[model samples]
Target chain A: MKSTLIIVALLLMLGGCKSTGGPTLYQQLDGKAGIERLIDSFINQIARDEKIIHYFEDANITHFRDGFINHLCALTDGPCEYIGDDMVAIHTGMNINETDFNHVVELLINAMNELNINHTVQNKVLAKMAPLRAEIIEI
Target chain B: MSMLKFFLGFIACLLPFSNFAGQGKLLATPGVSQVEGSAGGGLVPWAQLAGYATDDEFAINGFCSRADVSDYTLDVCGAQINLFNRVEFSYAEQHFDVPALNTKIEQSITGAKIRLYGDIVYSQWPQLSLGVQHKSLRDGAVATLVGAEKTSGTDIYLAASKLHLGALAGYNWFWNMTTRYSEANQLGLLGYGGANSRQKLLFEGSTAIFLSRDIAVGIEYRQKSNNLGLGEEDWRDVFVAWMPNKYVSVTAAWLDLGSIAGADDQTGWYLSVTGYW
Candidate 1:
């Protein structure tokens, strides 16, 4: 029983440690320039990925680049507001399945690896973006 | 040997599907295969299916495991098919060497699992699954000598699993709980039931912390029933698994099975490898 209590206390401590007032995610990501570099790397990754490349064939690359960088900046609490199209509106009619969406996520992870992003920061970024799956897929 | 030929044939059969092989789930999301041929830790079945298939894809996996303890050694080989990440079918052949008895026992298990609801990572609730395993003993002399009632039995289980991203000190945490109803004695190697002959509810659990995206260290506990009036015991293990990619994984564990049949302190080392396609 004493061991069980210790385990429970440890779990409670771990559970309570979510996102306290340390460095903001934006600062940890090195601010706007870092996000832009990430987006450029992500775009390059998507370009090389054949499985999901066709989805961008008719896309406006410059517009997408700017919108995505702004989106990331806003998502990460950087000093930016995304005045772009909604995620649902942008992904509608593309019929992107879960496989393709996950493929894109993998490509982004590859990009992050190439940039030598810390694993913890990458997980935070993915967590911030994961909820958008509902808005972006199977619509 | 014939087993090698059969394994080669199995690979040949999978060749046709290689062009459309599905790896839809994130790497290492689908847990490694268990001893009973289910997607789980080395000892306990988790709620996840066996391969990297999502709702729109299918996957196949093959695995082999061996546990060598003080008085016994268990070798198992199996294959699993995951359809749409919703259902799984598996088959496993087990060979048990009982050095004390100067004999060997063999059993085959056929298993099926269905995902009832939720996703391990994306859902608010834990992923739930229902599963069944039908075990048949190929050699029943030891079972009969132990006063077993039957050489075959079925186990039904309900399992729930969840993966918490960055939940444990910036690493991923995964946990699973399974409740099973069975009358199998020593996983049916000693056959099913006995004079006691009552089915009992059992509990199994596993928890793991992913040090990296590709590696996990975990512990598992499984409660067992002494249906045959033998001093069967609960099982526990500490395991480390490495999934370098979605296509392959390796696991090693130190097991403390307490006792089996009549032998006490049945501790061992276990190693397993799984290949996904």
Candidate 2:
């Protein structure tokens, strides 16, 4: 009976010590404004990366930036709705290969690193983006 | 010596003298090469492919490994290719030396692995693969003297692997489990089966914690069958691997091979160097 009580007490203590108020990804990325800046920097990196620049030659920079920011904000649980086209619809017939996709991911990681984003947050963001490879690569 | 010259030439060929341009795939995902020529931890095989190849690409890798124990020494050299991130074909040659017995054992292994389902990364489910290895021993007379049933055998295995990114305080965690059916003794160095001539099912498991993008530390446990009643026990190891770049990786481990051929508590150090493209 005493051991059971001790276990119950320990559980309560553990629960009490648990961190429930840690900053969310949205706040860690500094909300919509910071997301906008990240997208801007990411676009610049993509524009300069020769391996991926050709894919964006015909893209509309302003529209792509807006859509990307909104998508990123929504993905990070910010107060925004992604109004862009679905991944499959947007990438169909683009002939984007795995090499291109990985290059873009690398550029994004570089952008995040330049912005001093924490590694954990960077991985979380990348994990969210990784699933889109099915719809975007050679689809 | 010729062996040392070969080793040096291998390293020179794998050296990152010039960057190969336009390579895709994530870093360190394919993992370092195992002694058996598969992509995995130091001693055990994982379900991952052998190189930095994605679904639409192919890659090739080569490695050499050496293990020094209290009673014996082992050297392995092998190569493998990953096709479209799905299938892997490998070949390895192993040399075992027992100084006390003034004898040497040599074996050649051909292996193949096919990915069945899931992804190592970017998926909730673990990646699973099926593998087969055919081993042939060079010294048939020595094998028979050791009470082996055959000088050649096959091992079939199913392995599952998963990586949990940022699961532990911003660090990645890797897990793998393999089930194997085999009749080989001492991984086919002493040859197939034994006096009992029975194939047995065994289990192997590995878990790792990633310290960074390029470094990981892990532990492995492998169960073995004692068909000959030679007091062969299970194997275990603690290992650390470093992939400084996509082209090169190195692993070091402390391994326990239990008792082998009357040698008890056979503990050792294992080192391997790998190159991938």
Per-residue lDDT tens digits for candidate 2, residues A36-94, read 87898899898888878887888899988988998998887788788897888888889
lDDT of 2 by residue, B1-277 (tens): 2433454455456446324421476777787777677777877788987988777777777789998989999999887777778898887888899899898898888789999998887666999999998888878777788888899998898999988766555567677888999888888887778876554999887777778778988788787888677888888888999988888999999999999877899999999998886
Clashes, model 1: 0
Give the Å shift of residue B276 in candidate 2: 1.2
Chain A TM-score for model 2, please?
0.82
Q: Chain B TM-score per candidate, please.
A: 0.95, 0.91
Worst 10 residues of 1 chain A by lDDT: A1-10
Candidate 1 lDDT tens digits, B106-201: 888889999999889777789999999999888788899998989999999999999887676567788888999998888889998888766599
Clashing pairs in 1: none
Candidate 2 ranges with C-alpha deviation above 4 Å: A1-20, B1-22, B196-199
Per-model TM-score of chain A alone? 0.92, 0.82
Q: Rate the local accuracy (lDDT) of all candidates.
A: 0.87, 0.80
Highest DockQ: give the candidate number.
1
